[model samples]
Target: MSPIFMTLLLIVTLGVFAYTANRRWRLLMVGAADKRSDRVGDRVRATIEYAFAQKRMRRYPLAGIAHQVIFLGFLVLAIRSLILFSRGYVEDSSLILFAPHTVIGDVYSLLKDVFVVLVMLGTLVFFYYRLVVKLARMTLSTEGAIILGIIFVMMVADVVYDGAWINLRARAAGAEVTFSGWEPVGSVLALLFQDAGDGVLRCLAHVGFWTHTSLVLVFLNLLPRSKHFHVITAVPNVFLQNLTPRGRIAPIEDIEGKVEREETLGIKRIDQFSWKSILDFYTCTECGRCSDHCPATNTGKKLSPKHLTIDLRNFLYQHETALINPSRDRKGADAENAEYAKDLVDGVIDPEVLWACTSCRACETECPVFITYVDKIVDMRRYLVQERGEFPNELQTAFRSLETSMNPWGFSQDERGQWADGLNVPLISEKPDAEILFWVGCAPSFDERAKITTRATAQLLQRAGVEFAILGPEEQCTGDFARRAGNEFLFQTLAEANCGVLNGYNVKKIITTCPHCFNTLAHEYPDFGGNFEVIHHTEFLARLVREGKLVPKNRVERTIAFHDSCYLGRYNDVYDAPRDVLRAIPGVKLVEPEQTRDRGLCCGAGGAQMFKEEEPGDERVNHMRTEQLLATKPDAIASACPFCIRMLSDGLGDKERTDVEPLDVADVLLRSVEENVPAEQTAGA
Candidate 1:
């Protein structure tokens, strides 16, 4: 009767689980193609480290530790769950090699008991977090609470079942057994049922056994329907993470073929999202870590990365049948006007939410499972900009400026060399023999504040006796802003044009003061067949300092907080080079912001935010970042990116603290280098 009953239950539970899983798999298959299976070894290693090891969770120590315990407990308990299931069919529940009373079984039983307690404690910690301490970073959902309750009950049920079995066995033998192999928790619990009647003992054992087995099935079915579905999808999601440099948005291939194929230039509908993106939506744990660290969300913007994933995931499910069953649609015109005909941007996600993103990758960095947020946001932006011609009006001026002059500021290309006028900077045309092409990015070329950084970098390069030439009148914006702002066509045009010019020059290597330009030229331009060695000015300067070609002399003493530009640090993993440059200088006490390096906040200038008016928010992103640097009370702030310098300077101005100067790493190094230079050499020729 027991074997028959358990088999029927198992079949029913497994059938439901398979049905739900198949539905999600079909939904995933409906998405556009994305190659996530390349590099098998790397994917497996990433899965082990990120998914199994829970590497990212360690950022929050207590929560991380608690999760580790719970995770391990689940893995360990899975075997025990199997054993318990088998006990319903067979007399003995232990594995074939390790039966009750054996050394292996005894050791396994002991470990299982220890973990059972630890798992309960782990759940208790979360209960305190949710119900008592109430951490704001965690999403408080009844679903989450109920899941917790279910886990707690599962543990209790397992304990009760074990204890009741022990009690019944001892009673049947008419003896008091001491320290049995599988009875650590059971022994302790058995004492309570020892004096109970035979009928009561049997009832307790039956109830406990049924509850534990039934709840396992309940939890299995709960996945794919709740945020907890991460347990099923997270490992696969982490394995499939984009392996390219984080900043490299895949270029649109065959941009001109859209008219003939009736294909939208960018993602216009849910079906256009990549399979990996759909996996990302399904894998989200709803931990709220992404939104917690997101500058946009923290400062009152409508973009919460967590909620964005949730919204998209919900929409994916809401139209799952509509998306997966295209064949079921009516014939003729109704086929074209399918069930999921509603627009996604304004229909599902608000425009305010879309434009508020800074593309900082903070959310991606914080996500434990490596789910990307920027790619999705940018893809949708591409749709709005290219297909619908519906985006923020401020972007129009930027697009117009970029279209006509190849710079967002509408500055004449003739003035690109003006910053280095006194220094007699060589143009690539005039000095085609130069080794390095100094790519003076748009801000450095046009923005007043950034021009100083450009000049400082130029002076340092000259002082170091390195032969570098600028593009001068031929230089164009790298189209970083346009691309990030969703104007991919403009970016592609600019990239191809710049590649042609660079190829004409036969340039081998390039250096830039802007992280944006460096990232674009180094990572994104390669897609346009413009592959060339590119380095950030900070890194080049750091290398020069290390090689003893450029020495920082004289104590231009000041405490400076080094701001990590998102493009340089997170996008390209170039964090230490800029700091190493600052550290090379004598009498420069380098301080770090509360938010620094991979965890650094954005300056409201990235994602083309500098080119457009900031979305409505309580506090500006740059000002918030400036405040973090200001909290250190440094003499000045030092940054590598020209954009960062401008944003931080503007932030300091807004706060009326001009005394806290914003200086580039190059500027600080230049101050020390020039102090020892001959006054005549520094002066005009």
Candidate 2:
């Protein structure tokens, strides 16, 4: 090895990499500041689980296994690369501890050879995916193939260098090249060249050494310029992932101040996004796992989470010089750098793409690097709704209805407690000292079909001797729908009013049948000073049954397929409670749909889609989810969320599957709990 040439190679390649990385860093800083440095312990644990352990990648078995091997191989072979670099300066350098004859070195040599072979096999797996099988879910570009080729060649070159070096050493000692247990792969390779001359062997060693080392440096520089940038940013991205409750959307702070200051309401321009979001763009692996699982994408909607991130990232990189310029941040830069000031909604991303999202979090769930979609989509929608007054005509109506009547449907707030009229349910105003307040959501209070679930839940609580009271007319919409639909002003007004009411009553605990209400109250309300213990009815019922407070004695003979609400299952991780309630009923067999629990398909009702028509798609999301549940061949489809019940009921009707019933868990539980009661006396009946 030539020290002068190697030193020159190191200086030039390392210098180029440093410059490229610094440019990326500067671009990242161009976005607004974010707080990701807090909670060091939690960040470390997540980095270990999702990054080092490669937890989320394992969701797709073959690809996960292949990636794990390649990732671990890179880590193990990192030392080998460093050792190779050091040997350029000191020909016999093993850094003392890894000298060939020592036990520590022997073990490492064996591990290194094993991973070299494993790494090659791993590359072949991806080769099959990219070339042979030609998976549509991944970015099968020539660059991907080239990177894989570099890795494969790097492994081969390393083996060649080891084999030639072993042979050269034996020849120098005038001894035969004998196989050593510590160097199994290299020993085996050396046998192939044992018959070659010393000059040829030296030539082979030089070629192998130079090719491997040079290609390693080249690969290092290629990373920042390609999607392989994830190779550098993925771990940090995971470490800095949003650690707040998954269900809670970060609210816009100081809304009036921002409005008065004429600051952008939401993400009008790409630079308005926080740096963590910019990192999200950079760290996207383009693996399409997010899109594959996304309800909007699967249903042939305009939004593909992968492509959305990619489009923004491309726009960022396309205007990197202007965006990173300090002049761009100064006044009047908008006129000078008009391209950089372009609205992200219709310029970089189609408005329809943002509108189609269900906010089900499927994309976020499937993302191996923890890139988020809902927040970004909602932020863009905020710009559309608040800043530009350009949202779907339907959302405008919903917003007005919410503003006037405190519900999306414009139902009179005075009748909010009518659903519990005959169930002996008391209002919190009448019994202000009640232990828990039932937060009857808009759907349950106003929609006729959803009222049945509301009644059933109330009757069950009464039968269990749980002293719970309702908010009655004092309750307002939780603003989950408004916030998600990008009406931040309306959402904040509703949230503040609702919080004031609840706080006035000194409400400590709440029970709600709507997953949306439960989620907003428990996770989102704390941000507005409305902290309370919110429990979904199914969870409360499950606990009552567990504590021997509510016994299900009557036999409700039915095979039920429980449909998971995305808010309940994916957002809040409340999968088991509903299932537990269903299982407790005698003669009721609980079955599961293929896409149940966290992977459950959206009912197409979240993100305020319930109040508006779904964006055009190949199929309605709820219809697709209904077909999945129907595949289980259940006597009934049971769910806990009022919105889910309503959408699924419509799904059943649309499919003309009237023979199958769509009942809420409370509806089914009421049938069993009210033993020997007349059928018409039951809440559902």
Candidate 3:
């Protein structure tokens, strides 16, 4: 081996990598500051679970196992790479403890040999995926092929070098070469070279050694320039993942003050994204797993989470110098950089792309690196709605209604409690010291079908004898849609006013039938000084049944397929409560849809899509979801959220499957408790 050439190769490649890494660091710093350093123990545990264990990757079994094999192989072969590097400068490649024939050395060599074979197998799997299978979800780039080729070739060279080294040593010792368990792969390969002359063996050894070493350096330099950069950033990104409640959108602090200062309200510019978000951009593996599970992308919407991240990353890289330059004027930059600084909504990202998202968290749930799309999508929407006043025209009417009537549909605020009129449900104003406050959300208060659920929930609570009262007219929209749709000002106004009322009543606990309201109240309301123990109504009802406070005496024989609300299931992980309540009812067989629980399809009512028309797609998300639930061939479809009920009911109507009733979990449970009473009669019974 030539030490001089090896040192020079290391110097050139390492020096280039250093320069590239420095530029990437500067570009990352261009983003706004984000705090992710807190919660040390939790972060380390998460890194170990998600990054090291490759937990989420297991969702795709074949690819998950293949990627994991390669990852573990890299860890095992790392020492072998270091040994080769040391061999360039020294006579003996191994350090003192790891010298060949020693127990530690033999163990290390055995592990290295195994991983060499495994790594090749792993690369072959990816080669199959990229070249043979040509998975639609993956980015089939030439760069990806080249990287895989480098890896496969590198593993081959390592084993060849080992084989050549073993043969030379055996010849020098005047011993016959044979298979050995310690260096199984190398010894088997050595048998092939035993008859070759020393000259040829030496040449092959040098070829293998140099190729593996040089490729290692070459691969290092390629990382920062390619999507393969995730190899370097994924671990840190997983560790620094947002620790806030999954459902809560971080509020725009001091919105009015920022307006007075004329600062960008949300992510108007690329650099407005936080450093963590920039790291997310860097960590994207382009595996397309996020977009694969995305309801919008699945339905052929313009928003592919994978492409969105890649586009932003490409933009950042393309204008790195301008963005990182402290002295450069963004507005006065060269034409290309000036264009790069333009609003991302229409320039880099289409507004339709933003509008198509359901805020379902499907992408976030599937991202192995914990790269979040919902928050970023909502942040950009904030700038469009609040600053530019450019959003879906339908949102204007919804926003106006929310502003005028404390509800998105402009239902009279005074009529909010009318849904519970026949059920004898008390208002918080009438029973301020009630044990729990039922926060009946906007849809339940106004929508006709949703009112049935509201009445059923009230009747259940009345039967259970749980001391609970409704906010009724005192309640306002929890602003879940407003915040998600990017009207932070309106959300905050409503959130504050509601908090004042709840605080005045000294409300310590809350139960809501709407998943959106449950999520907002349980997670987001804390930002508005409204901290209370929030529980979804299904959860409360389940607890009541568990405690024997309410019993399902009648057999309402039906096959019920339960649809999980994204806000409840993905956001809060409340999959079991509704199912438990459903299971408790006699003669009701609870079945799950093909896509259930965390992987459930969205009902297409979230992110203000209930108010605005869906962004054009091949099919409506709700229709697709409804079809999934219908595939179970159940007599009824059950869901806990009012929005989900409304959407699924519409989906049922669209399919002319009106005979298959769309019932709320409460609606179904109340029938059993009330001895199979008709829903209309249950309220008065």
Instruction: Pick the winner on TM-score between candidates 1 and 2.
Output: 2
TM-score computed on alpha carbons, candidate 2: 0.98
Model 1 ranges with Cα > 4 A deviation: 167-176, 180-183, 190-199, 330-332, 676-685
lDDT against true structure, model 2: 0.90
- Report the C-alpha lDDT of model 3 over 1-685, residue by residue, as the tens digit: 7789889988999999999999999888888989898999999999999999999989889888889889889888778888888889984669676898899999999999998998899899999999999999999999999999999999999988888989998889898999999999999999988888999899889999999999998998999999999999999999999998999899999998998998888898898899999999999999998999999999989999999999999988988987776667554546435756788988899999999999999999999999999999999999999889999889999999999998988889999888877678888888888999988888888888888888888888989888989888888898999998999999999999999999999999998999999999889989989899999999999999999998998887889999999999999999999999999999999999988999999999998889999999899999999999999999899999988988999999889996788888888888999865875642211
Measured with C-alpha atoms, the lDDT of residue 287 in candidate 2 is 90
Candidate 2 — which residues are off by over 4 angstroms?
328-337, 677-685
Cα deviation of 601, candidate 3, in Å? 0.8
What's the distance in Å from true for residue 652, model 1?
A: 1.1
lDDT of 1 by residue, 4-50 (tens): 88998999998999999999999999888998778999889988998
Model 1 CA lDDT for position 649: 87
For model 1, state the Cα shift of residue 248 in Å. 1.0
